[model samples]
Target chain A: MVTTAAQKPILLSGNEAVALGALAAGVRFYAGYPITPSTEIAEVLAVELPKIGGKFIQMEDEIASMGAVIGASLAGSKSLTATSGPGFSLMQEHIGYAAMAEVPCVIVDVMRGGPSTGLPTKTSQADIMQAKYGSHGDYPSFALMPNSVLECYTLTIKAFNFSEKYRVPVILLSDEVIGHMRERVVLPDPATLEIINRKAPTEPREWYRHYPDKTTGIAPMASFGEGYRYHVTGLTHEEHGFDATSQEVAKLLEKFKNKEIRNTKELTMCESFCMEDAEICIFAAGSVARSARQAVRILREKGVKAGLLRPQLVWPFPKMPVEEVYDQVRFILVPEMNVGQLRKEVERLRTNMRVKVKGLNVLNSVMITAEQVVERVLQIDFRSGSESEGGTSNG
Target chain B: MADATNQTAEPVDRHSWLRGNKKFPHMWCPGCGLGTLLNTVIRVFVAKGYDKNETVVISGIGCTGRIPVYVDCNTLHTAHGRALTFATGVKLAKPNLKVIVFMGDGDAVAIGGNHFIHAARRNIDITAVVVNNSTYGMTGGQHSPTTPLGMKAPTAVTGNIDPPFDICNLAVAAGATFVARSTIFHYQQTFRLLSEALEHKGFSVLEVVSHCHTSFGRINKLGSHLDMLKQQRDHAVVFTPELDVEKARAEGKDLVIGLLKKDATRPEYCDQYEKLVIQPSQAKQNRGGV
Candidate 1:
């Protein structure tokens, strides 16, 4: 069944596509817990990894799964783990540890409606803030939101690439709608796919700094048991990876933040539709972006000059592209499956702009429909038009 | 050697496995038993002729967790109670390398107990040394899960109503192939037990009954570190499966300090995984290469 002849376009859920993408990315180890919306990623990896000489273990719990992935990564394996809200919450401590220690790994959080397991079988974008600040401390993180099943595959591979290239944990944030939704994906030929391996140390073992404070801020990594007997700690450490508490050390450790922020242009990925000549634009991410796209098409047909701005790179939230369209648009409609998570970010970008940013939020894990978005857009337009006419008539 | 220019071939002295001057003036307080436990493992490493390059020492958060830092080996100081989980990956990924984990009582028995039991049940080939001081030493004298009943701590000022865990017995029950207990006062037995645990092929647990003079002792009025060591000496009794539990109870010597369980029948975890999953996949790939 795995023969090249059988490698035609096949229907796959977003979760299954993610597993295949991880395989294509040379993910040699996977440790995950069975949780709603994200369990299929684990189930698929468990069967697929063993066939491809990769190791997959359904850990005792989410916390252990995160721990195992970090360990595997440290031992020179492209490792991953997938979970949802509650499990992602349990993994926060280890996620912070991975960031501090600079272990490269990927985490897939298929977003579920939650303050605490709110909607397991349902979807929500409420975890957007949690993905950025859930782990305690000020460390850099990369989170990519996939709008389609195909994006799920490509973005998951991109997540691995970014994690290894930057030495940080990359979160592939999907929702139940995208995670469980099935679509046809044309499998890429393995030979044509570009695979990126981590940069190895060029210096002598005595001089190698696992956490080097250099120009690029990325230290060359040496896996365990290759004769580089070094110390790795979650504690704030100096360049050589020993515990330090001085103010200078704290200042030096700021490289983690600088590395990602400086490279934000490359890391920030987004897609804009018909933004060249638009009066009103819809801002959305994750699976809801698909609906926004459809709504934009309908609004354009109705001659309302509507467009859609979908953020593929959700974190370090792509401000430049959105700012580019700020003057071009009269209003921005932010639609989400939750009560205004990403909407707040969009609203933050609205500083002193006459462009009114309105949130079209849906709770209880119900997806925002295209018709609902069209209704909101038409209502806002009507209200804006009436206000303008009323002011002129009163004068 | 071409790719590993940073690693200089330094001489390893039999008397010292310490990393370098960077880790000098160790963090362990005066007369802390953690040093003795760490020294015993280093001696076994040298005695067993294990390559420093092939040994990875992992630890969790605690005073005991700091043991890996002072050693001149590949070390990973991970989050609290997650050393075994990390070691499981290290051992499975590179089965030839020796993975040893050092954790405290609270780390192993309380927060990390689930990982410990699962690692043991799977019988993964790794040596886990649990340093039992009966209190959270690093965070101050708080009562841990292994704190003895009626003992005083910061959290249990009056007395701890909960009974302490018999760590060796717990490990034995958890399916650890090799389980043993020894006190800091019993130096020879500590060395022997640690040596044996390292030599065991499957999941081996050696619980070292150590004292935290800073926290547990100061609160309980257990005198200086030496006096606590004497207390460990006085309370110790050799353990044997044939020993009558009632007699030991009546003798007021419930602390059994010796090898508790040793069974080598069960297949090791990583070995089975490699055989079942890894080898077949490799053979298929190789056969398809034709």
Candidate 2:
């Protein structure tokens, strides 16, 4: 939001900012089951949503919450749900359903440690891979990762905007450290914020099709009782109310799902920190990015020429900024709370094996500190080129 | 087969709400009770004059769940057992819509029991049509939560040791504003109960006791689909508030059919939401609360 000057800076946690951001982004309905590190989001919305005449429902479980959110969105409400790793797993089926059905909604996964209930109330950026590939089958996703409280508020609004505009489910990956960490954020004027809403069909009711015969396959969705009388199912079907479609329709769908490349240039919400004339770079996102930035500054002061490539929008991978960093840098240091989940992704972009890529993975239910990253970078003997960290994902 | 696209309000006939022969031959086995359940539900919808546009028929994954696919209205076929949650969202978001959820016994109780009970507990303005077939027919006949004790299915080749849940009793106990039960054989009674259930304001659950005659019957040697229909007729007795169900056990009748309970005074979920949440905020905004 553009303002002559920002309003008074109010101290709010990352979770609080997310809750406020959802409201500002025109999210009118919320369905969720409370889970650790993400419960505050539900708690905040439960109190605030009712004040604005918005709907909030605590569903029986994570599965029900996801289902309800989709249902509410179909009936023409901007809906959202928040949960942690365990809950996110439960939501995978419905997430796939929303994508296949082309329903617009937002899901916030406040990252907590887990393969299965691994660590609650602990900070870990472990769910980066899960957010992209947890749900079976491909669906176009626009995900945002907020490293700070301010980014939490702004990126959340952007997440909703992208979700509505593209008619896809957007994910917000906020880790426990950032979710619980309080920061002074200057809240923007509501009027100044740019809010995007899902497109409505202008065609007559008699000619209405839930999925139109158009390229990109994005159709203007009608609310359930608004008299358009459309059909939605998880089944693969054609434009009309006909049952299932053949192989021809499946080929037409190739352009529709996960095809968010050239169109979403504005969605590359990554930042380059002190990368000018740097030989070493760090790739990180979410809470880990904060430490990476600090480590970059520390390395630069010591004349190491280190920089950081932080992906605020983790998916679609922010390729250009990464390529710019990768082309110039001699070594890429990826430090994260998880055991190198994102490091595997960075390795894929390595066109040159000469560029030493390594991850300082810490999965001890604690935040990766700036000092630890600085130590990891300083310990690297550049001339000898003796690498200790594994380079390949399979390795 | 003629294209069923944009057929504007044809004369109220059996084909009006149905997709007609377009989606046929229908997927169900010839003797499956799903056909009876579907026809009766459509009949009730027609008699009650439910505008197709203003209605949403949702279903979970089952032969019964296929009801939404065949109905010419706003239909949503969602995940198995989660239809109630989805229906809840649709109804709560827009109170004007009549949201009906159709689920099989396994879908409604086994995988979806938590949602089922809670939806009733909240007394939300949605009609739950639970077709209790006592088996998971879609996946071959397997013993479901409603499968009677000592009944045989593929999963329970030996007699089923697990006790079955009474769908109507579960709904009533879970605070459903209207609860009723009927078999596919009792066409008129099923239609009447379904019609009343749809008319009720709060959560209304109508349990249609159906049969997976091909699977359950063949395994248990219970004869054909006709024999299963005869069994539903013989086993069922009309439920009355004054009738002693314990006394009926002596008569060898276990199934209780008809309206078990209807409570009109309890506040419907949607109306309460409108009054408590919507009205207060509107008043505040009118008073320049913003």
Candidate 3:
């Protein structure tokens, strides 16, 4: 069915935008367990999916939900699942399985405060590392962080496109603030947006190899009921999807998939604000990015040259964008909800550049306000040579 | 492959239903009941004439989970204890596709208990083949949820104190449309139960009581697989009221076999969704109601 086109500037929360974005991306199936801050996405899809012949199931648990999403996608349905901290941890097992089997599906983790249900109704970006290293083994991960209601729609669409085209799992990292905040934005007509799907093999059934080696490093996928009768297992497998213990089979699943996904530079998107002639760069994402935007304006009005570099995708790390910030600014301050999570990624890319990176981290179950970021940036004495090498401050 | 007895004109083309001839000399140990169960499973698929393309077999992690690898059909080998959830998605996506799940006793009643009961409660159209070997054989003879009381294993070295589960009774209590139990020694009964499960419209579970002699038996001093099979064959009896009930109990056995429940009138999951959710939405759409 064609998409239900929209024209008006509708008021929608970030979670609601995600539900609509999934519909526009042609997601026909969603299996998820409702968790705090993310349940609205499930609620919206539960109401909307049936109107367009789509399927929505509230599974027994997060693990079952992730498993069901993979199964639906294998049966040729575009699928998605949404969850939060503890639930996201449960989904890591199947997330790794989807990576090895090369099943195209999306998982949205609306970040909440945690070390196991630390704060249910509060916001945090603590899942930054979990998005990449949560699951065992080496696999490719593409994570997109949306800072607003509008971006929640756009990036969820991008999430599906990347998951399908790369034949790998794509994670949409939505924090509690982005998931709950309501904003008025004109929704894009679904036809005007880009929607990419996995390429289907044109060859006959007998000649089909589920994971054929290609120069582009991605093989066409065939659905389960399409008479292909292919095998899919979590175990390491050769091209035809049968299990094998050889090193060649082990490298086949990880090597090419990582190369193809990481090489796609377009997947790593970053936004720059007020950096025409700036000295201090503010780095943040998701809810903190919105605060950083406001902090940039306050800093400029106060006669301090401050700019912002917000990365949309955090997995491939977007080193080029951060390097651009390093070249233009000698001091960088990262304000985030979690104490030194995304800040660690920024410091890791410290490179050989003689720049001072500091983090204004808050983990009090509250957001890092714009005033706190401005206060921390003003206090960073970049002239002190001893503190020039990467330092941190808890707000 | 074991030929089905007590039947007329059963399909004999077993090779056609199996994956490839190279996959033969399967990885199962000699005298393993899983192999016997697989042999009978293929015969049932052949006899029932299930399409290799449309029939999707899903399994969770364990020895029983590996059965999908040998079936020449659309197959999925999922994480431990998650096959029913996966099979639920497959059946919901394409209701016409035949979805079957193979799970071991531990994979079914232990780690997968929540999913197992929920799948039956939902009355989803998927047949679950739970091979109850009373132990986690793949993990080297750890006692499972179905391991008999006082049975010995590596995990239960001093003899298991935990009471065992009845797989069919669990399914029946969980609202499954069809439920049955039969030992591998009762080959004909097991064959019939599996065939019935495949054809059932809603959630159907056929608990095939198997013996892991290498694991569950050897540690308990139960001799070889043949001895275990002999014990099962001697104890198991068809559920019939006409038999001598007092005598059977005195001999240490009773009605422990045959179909426990079959209710065809219960509404199926996918059918209910189509009727209750889709039809009204489509009606609203046709009438120009947003």
Candidate of highest lDDT: 3
Candidate 1: segments with Cα more than 4 A from true spot = A1-7, A385-395, B1-12, B280-290
lDDT of 2 by residue, A232-312 (tens): 887766776455557646753664553567465776877888877888888888888898898888888887888888898
How many pairs of residues collide in each model? 5, 0, 0
Binned by DockQ into CAPRI classes (incorrect, acceptable, medium, high), candidate 1 is medium
DockQ for each model: 0.61, 0.61, 0.80
lDDT of 3: 0.86
Give one digit per residue, the lDDT tens place, for model 1 in A1-395: 22143458888899988988898888989998899989999987776777776788878999999998998898899999999999999998888888888898999999998889688998889888888999988988789999888888888888998889888898999998999999987777767666677899988888878888774667689999888888999999987788876964765567877767787678679898988788898999988888899999999899989989999999878988777777788888888876677877887776546877777877756778899888888988989734421110100
Candidate with better DockQ, 2 vs 3: 3
Question: What would the TM-score be for candidate 3 when compared with the true structure?
Answer: 0.95
User: What order do you get sorting by DockQ, best first?
Assistant: 3, 2, 1
RMSD to true structure for each model, in Å? 4.8, 4.0, 2.5
Once fitted onto the true fold, the runs of candidate 3 whose alpha carbons sit more than 4 angstroms away are A1-6, A256-262, A381-395, B1-12, B241-249, B288-290
Question: Which scores greater on TM-score, model 2 or model 3?
Answer: 3
For every model in order, the TM-score on chain A comes to 0.94, 0.93, 0.95
Candidate 3, residues A18-101, lDDT tens digits: the string is 988899898999999989989999998887888888898999999999999999999999999999999999999999999888
What value of lDDT does candidate 1 attain over all alpha carbons? Answer: 0.85
Taken in order, the candidates have interface RMSDs of 1.5, 1.8, 0.8
